[model samples]
Target: MKRDKISVVGFMGSGKTTIGLLLANFLNYFFYDLDEYIEKKEGKSIKDIFADYGEEHFRNLESFYLKELIEKHNKIVISTGGGIIKREINRKLLKEKTFVVFLDGSFEVFMNRLEGTEEKDKRPLMSLGKDELYNLWISRKPLYEEVATLKINVDSKTPYQIVREILDFYGKM
Candidate 1:
C-alpha cells in the first residue's frame, strides 16, 4: 500500500531519531520525534516524567500524544519511542497511517552507543545492567518485528547509510 507518511521505530540507541531526521530531510517531510513531543507537551524532561509519574503513566501519555500526532499530521516522518509498539492500538494506527520501519541493532552496539550517556537517569529502562538490558532486548525484539513493515539492521551502519537503506526498502531511492 502507498503511504504519505513514514514512522521509524526501534530500541533505544538504534538511531531512529538521527536517521529519521535525515530521511525526513531527504523526503522533504516534517519530522516528529514522539518522545520529544511528549516532553514538550508535559513541560518536563522524560527523566522527570519517569521519576515523578512512573512508566505506566508516561506510557499512557505517550499513547495519547501518538494518537493526536497521527491524526493531525501527514507527509511526515515520526520517530516513535522504543516501547511504542507495546500497545496494539498504536501498532494498528501506525500500520494504517504510515510506513513503519524497524531499525534493528545488536545489544552490544546499543550499549556501546549509549555508554557514558547522561540520559540514563531520564531513561529508566536503561538503568539496568548488561544482562538485564540483553533480556529486555530479547523480549522486545519480537514486538518490534511484528509491527514493522520493513526491518533494517543498523549494527555497523552510519545514520546516512541507514537512511539510504530505508529509502531503498521503501522503493523511494
Candidate 2:
C-alpha cells in the first residue's frame, strides 16, 4: 500500500493504543494516540474535558486533532478515540489519508478489558449501562466498517499478536 499512515479505530477497550504502539514500532513509524494528544493540547484530562465542557466540545477537539494529525504527519500510526468515527468528515479523511483498521471485539471482551481499570471512567461514554453501550456499539460498528481498510477481531488476541495480524493483513509481513 502507498498509504503512509495507519489509523486504528474501534470501541473503547479494544486495544487500539497498545496495538498501535506495537505496530508503529514494528514498522518504524511514529505513533500518536489521539486522546493523549487532545489532553495535552487542552491541558486537561479527557474526563475533566467532558465534565467541564461537554461531550460536544470534546468531540470537536477530537475532530480538530484528527484532521490536524492527518494533514500534518506521515508514516505515523494514530490511535483514535472510539467515537472519532462518528463524524462523516473524519470518516472520509481517515479512509482517504490512511489505512484505517477497525479492531473488532465483543461487548464481553470490551467490558472485561475495562473492568477494574482507572482509565474506564476517563471515557465519557463508559458511564452508560450495558444496554446503552451495546446499542452504541451496534450503531457505530457499521461506521467503523465503512472506513476501515482492514478489520481484525481482537477478542482473544494479545497486543503483540494483534500487531502481527495487522502487519500481515497490511501486507507488511
Candidate 3:
C-alpha cells in the first residue's frame, strides 16, 4: 500500500527540511516543516517559544499540532523536529499515521552541516557543548531507528541525492 503522507525524521543537520522539500517537489506533494508550522501557528519563532515557555511547553504544543496535521492533511511530506520522537504519543502517531523515514549521518557530518551559521545558534539545543551534542545525538539515534519505516544513511549524500534515494525506495515499496 502507498501511504499518502511521508514523515522525515532525523537528528539536527541530517537534512530533513532540505530533503523533504525536494522529495515533495518530486512527488508533487505538499511540504511542511513541523517547526515552521508551529512557529507560524503560535506567532512566535521556535527560539522565542523555547525562551519564553520552555521545552516542555513547546513539546506539548508539538504533540497537539502534529496530531492536528495528521488528522487534517494528506498527500504531504512532513519534516519533523529532531526531538519529536522523544515523546511516546508522537511516536505512536507517527508509526500508525505516516510512512516514516529516518535520515542518519555521522556526528562529524552533523557538525559540518551546522558549522559557521548564526542560524544554528537559534536552535534551543545548540547551547550544548560538543560532547553533550554528541551524546544527545547518540541517544536520539536509536529512537529514530525504532520509529522509521525506512532508514537512509546520508553521510555523503546531497539533498537531491537523498530525495532520489527516498523516491526510489518509496517506489519499490
Each candidate structure's count of clashing pairs: 0, 0, 0
TM-scores, all models, native as reference: 0.94, 0.96, 0.97
Q: Which runs in model 3 stand beyond 4 Å of their true positions? A: none
lDDT (10s digit) by residue, model 1, range 1-173: 64768899988988888989999999899999998999999999887898899988988998899989888988889999988988888888888778899999888888788778775556778877879878888888998888788999999888888888888878852
Candidate 1: misplaced stretches above 4 Å?
Answer: none
After superposition, which runs of candidate 2 have C-alpha atoms over 4 Å from their true positions? none
**Candidate 1 — which pairs collide?**
none
Ranked by TM-score, the better of candidates 2 and 3 is 3
Error of 1 at 134 (Å): 1.2
Worst 10 residues of 1 by lDDT: 118-127
Please give, for residues 7-109, the per-residue lDDT of candidate 2 as tens digits: 9999998999998999999999999999999999999999999999999999899999998998898899999999998999899989988999899989889
What ordering of candidates by TM-score runs from best to worst? Answer: 3, 2, 1
- Against the true structure, candidate 1 reaches a TM-score of 0.94
Global lDDT of model 1: 0.86
